[model samples]
Each structure stands twice: as C-alpha cells, then as structure tokens.
Target: MTIADLHTLTGAYAVGALPEREAADFRGHLTRCAACAQEVREFRETAARLALAVAEVPPAALRVRVMAALPEVRQLPPVPAGARGRVVSLRDRRWRHRLPYLAAAACLVAAAVATGVAVEARRDADTQRDRGVVAEQRARVVSALAAAPDAAFHTGALTGGGSATVVSSTRLGAAAILYRDLPPLPGSRVYELWYSRDDVMVPAGLVDTKDPSGSLLLQGHPNGAVGVGVTVEPHGGSDTPSGSPLVVVPL
Candidate 1:
C-alpha cells in the first residue's frame, strides 16, 4: 500500500511477526524497496544475535528461564506469488565469468569518484555563495530589530515542554523568534510559529521538531503586532492557527 502503511509493518517484518496477509505484503514490498529490505535484514540479524547471546546451559531449569523471558513469536507472512525463484545469493558464481568487466567497472568507478569529487567541490562553492546572500539578509533584519523600540527578545521556559524567545523592534517594526528545548514530533504533525501585530495574526516558518532538542528559527515583523504565539499544527501549517499555542512569548 502506502509507505506509511509499509512502515507500520517494518518491526513485525524484522521480527518475522506478521500474519499471512501482512507478511506477504511486506515480502512483495521488499522486492522493490531496497532500503526497507536492508533495514529488515539488519534488524533480523541483530535479533538472531540477541537470541544466541543466552547461555546454552545443560541444566533443565535454564529452559524455564529462557522460555519465560522470550517474547511470543508471530507467524511469518506468506511469500508473495511475485517472489518467485530462489533468493539471489550475494556471492553468486556468475560474477566469476565477468571478472574482466568487473575490473573495467572498478576503473570506471575510480574515474567516476574523481568526477564526483569535482562536482561536489563546485556544489560547495555554490552553497557558500547562497549562504553569503542569506547571511546578508539576516544581518539586515537583525540590524533593523536592534533599532526598533519596545522589542523584547529573551529565551524562556516552555509551558509544559521547551523554551523559546522573541526579539522585536516595535519602532522598526520587525521581529525574529527562536525556540529551543522541544521534543521530536510524529510525522503526522508539525510545530508552527506565529506573530500577532495587534489583532491580526501572521504565520512564521515551521519549526523543526525532528531533533530531541528542537530549535525553531522564524523571522517576520508583522505590522502593529504586540504579541507572538507558537502552536502545534498539521504539517505545512495553516493561514490561521488551528491548534492551541504551545508557547506564547509576548513582544
């Protein structure tokens, strides 16, 4: 089905815990999804190693302890009909016949690597150029905020979670807000920042909550805004704040 649906089955697939239908779906997906298949194989190998770590003592009492600690095993899902023929062996003997091509490929790969390095060097240069532009823009905003009056910007504790701060210039009419000490959010939701100039509320950039120590950087100086707010919203956010504000640091 969908990637999210497939993701739900990853743990079960890794542990061979799926039912017939679910397992079959996972297997069918595995054929095309190299990344997921690799993860599953790695997880399976780790589990097998963990199982082997228990001491293999001859005492009959040891069996009771092992069985008691063991988690219930789920049945493997049925292999999809599309998963025909034997699994391809990583160490196929067919490669032996292509040693020459393999060597040629290796040389080509070396050349490609050199070419890649050159490409990356150019990209780095371009990135630096873009960063310079962004830095100039940021400097101008900060300078404007510095000149503005009634601008209060300081980091403070989160209501029940993390901490945030706002820097603004009521005179210059601009603000920059930053937040820290937030937990990661599930993929279903994203945290958003907002600015209120008097009665009208304007959106700030979405906060990145993927990090355990989340940080959000937003730059927007709403006209005639006296208050600011932060809220947890659906991904991509909305024109109006739908969810309750997690943090409200007044400017």
Candidate 2:
C-alpha cells in the first residue's frame, strides 16, 4: 500500500478498529515499509494513553440508544421482488460512515503519545548505559593504581593531559592510570598505555583525554607491569608491540 493509504488508516491501525481484511493488509504493508512502521508506533502510543485517561465506559443509555437505532430492515432471500434497492436515509448513512473516522482519530492521538513516551525511555536507557561505562572505567583505574608496588605511586598526575584519582582500593591488586600533558593522535592512530614487567610488555588500552596537553585519566595498570609506557598504534592497540614509545615511567 502507498504511504498516503497508511496515513489515512493510521488511526484505525492504532485503535485496532479496522476490519479484519483491512487490518491484515495494513500489517503486511507496515512490515515492508519503514515510514508506516514508525507512524504506527507513534499512533499506538497515543491511543494507549487516551484509553487510560478515558477509563470510564460510555454511558449505558447512550450505548443502548446507538444499538437500538440500527436499521431494522430485514434482508430477504434473493428473489425478483427483493431485488429492488431499499433506500437508506441519507442522514443516517452519513452518521454511520463518520463513526469509523472518529474512532480512528482517537486511536491516532493515543498512538502519538505512546510513541513519545517510548522515545524518551530509549534516550534514558542510552544515557544510563554511557554512565555505566564511565563508572566501570573509573573502577578499573582505581584497581590498577592499588596494584602499584608503592601506594604513593598510586596517585595519578593531573598536570594537564588528563588526571586520574583513585576511586577504589587496589589492595587486592590493580593499578589506576591517570595522566595529563600529551598531544592528540592522528586519525589513523591512537595513544595506548602499556605496563612492562620483567621486560615483558602488557597492553593497557586506548585512552582519550581529548587534548594533546590535556590530562587524560585511564583505567589502572595491567596485572603485572613494572614500568608504564605510552605508544602510538592503529586506533586500537595491538596484542604484540608496534610503534614507538611516547612516554615511559619506571616503577
């Protein structure tokens, strides 16, 4: 179905008020169409909220009146005499036709509201995830610093590249990494931190202080690094060493 058709039926889809055939057809269309899917999601959200806000059922008298007013004309068996068209009052027919439209509009409004809520919920989840990453990095740094041979060395420099402050204990063995004063790497390269132990090098991780001279704090030292080294490598550090050392601090 075309986008215009979907728009016309958006309310019906939101309220689930479409005829079975029409509903099925629309569902098929939505599956293949991105725009319609988005519209349906929005409309459904709006419809749900409207339903809750209007929790009270229609008055019994109104319902009864509508039911009672249905045309009472009987349908006779197909025959020559029954073949003539029975004229339905223009006014009654018009009102009957308008009902679906009204219902659809209500559903559409509800769907819109629902979509908004969903978007907001997704945004909140993303923000929470970002915060979690930062917290996790902080923990790693704290642990590394604690692993330092000397507790005093656990302190990270805030001289300007980036700063590292111990967030938790490393008594169990972990080192926190924090430093400032270095330049930004090129697009094709990255700055990596490393820890050396007994001449064996252990890769730390990629860091981002953002400023060439800005103090960038990183997660702590590796499990057994006796010395700290910074190196430039491809965006991500390699398992085996590649590139020249940028800085080296002996333990």
Candidate 3:
C-alpha cells in the first residue's frame, strides 16, 4: 500500500478493525515507521480514556454502517499439529515469576484494542469532513478559471531559457498556468509554483507535470502577487523559494 494509505489505516489497525492478514501487514510497517507507531500510541491512549467515560450501548445503525464499510475479516492461519516448542532459555525460566505482570499487560492491550474501534469511527468522520472541504476548494478554483477572460492571459520567459503563461483574473484572485521547454528534474525533484510582488516572492504551490509540457490551475492566489514563478525544489516544495525561478511569467 502507499504510505498515505498505510497512514490512514493506523487507527483501524490499533483497534483491530483490519482483517488478520492486513493487521499483520501493518505490524511490519509499524516496526519500520516510528511516526506511525507514535500515532498509534497517541490514539490508543485517547481511546482508553474515552472508553472509561462512556457506558452507553452503541446504535445498531452504526454497527451496520461500520461492518458494511469494512473488508472481510480473515481467520488466523492454523498451527501445524506437529509443531514443537523450543527448549526454554535460562532468561525465560527467570521471567516465569513475572507472569502476573505479563497477564496484566495483555489485558491492557486488549482493552486498548477495544477502545480503538470507537476512535476509528471518529477518525472516519473527520476524514470525510476534510475531503469535503478540499472538494469545495477545488470546485471554486475550476469555476474561477472557467470564467477568466482572454485579456487575463499573461506570458513571460524562464531564467533557464523556457517560456510560460499564466491566465489570471485579479477580480477572482486566481490563475491557470501552462509552460513548455522546461526540462524535468531527476528522481523525486520537480517544479514548484510561486507568486511575486514588489520584488518579494511568495509560494503559490507545486507542480508535478512529468512531461516536457503541461497545464495547471492555481488556486488561492497570494495576497499581492503581480507575477508567477516556477522553480526546482525537492518533491514536496518549501515555504521559501530554494533558488532563482526557472520560469517567470508576468501577471
């Protein structure tokens, strides 16, 4: 699974919402990604605290909804009949006296797992809310671009000898972008967008156009941008421009 998708499932895995096979897969990821482990620990603690405060029966409709959304849960693989245990080490023998503490730890883990289900439900709602907000923003950007007039088109040349155009509407405070002759970067590097005014450049966003040429929509125009700029940056981009922009289009 992609890293983002795996991150999304951390809450579900903490509460055992995943099938046995999928949970095992996430367990392997937990060993590698410390951030994911930290998230699970935090969410588990929240779940445990909320569980103690609530004793009400869950709505039947909620149960049906959750079950419908979940994938089929897998049963555990059977143990071989002839499998044998290894001889106990001296360390194991010494630890036998701590069985009571071990049992308590197991109970805590089970309780945390139970509370995690409730936490996952809340997370699902938040995720849906976030998605809705993003969808609405994208819709506004599209509408703004579609309504921009021909006189709004502005063009300029890149510092590295390429050309770009920005179709902008100051009234709407948005722009649509297209550029060509700009070479692509290797590996995870790509072009990032910026807006400049009064000689100060502000980041607009990033572009992931893999081909030699492409078009993009610029939403949420910077406060005082009189021009658009594009530069080479690391994959996700930076708060400030890393270097002089390779593409500069006057707006």
Point to the candidate with the largest TM-score: 1
Candidate 3: where is the Cα deviation over 4 Å?
A: 1-151
- Clash count for candidate 3 is 0
Error of 3 at 3 (Å): 58
Candidates' TM-scores?
Answer: 0.47, 0.43, 0.41
| Candidates 1 and 2, the one with greater TM-score | 1
Best by lDDT: 3
lDDT of 2 by residue, 73-185 (tens): 22323535653576658996896599678667766665665565557556666766775566556543433333222332433442225433221223435543445445555
Error of 2 at 41 (Å): 55
Per residue, candidate 1 scores C-alpha lDDT tens digits across 1-251 of 67677865654576655678988988999898888788677555433432332213234543554454333322334657875666655565476467668767766766665565557556666766675565556544543443232444555566668776666655666666545557667777877778865666689788656643422336565566666787778888888989677767776
Ranking by lDDT: 3, 1, 2
For model 3, the run of ten residues with the poorest summed lDDT: 47-56
Q: Count the backbone clashes (under 3 Å) in each candidate.
A: 5, 41, 0
In model 1, the runs with Cα more than 4 Å from the true position are 1-112, 147-150, 197-200, 210-220
Is candidate 1 or 2 superior in lDDT? 1
Local distance difference test values of all predictions, in order: 0.61, 0.53, 0.65
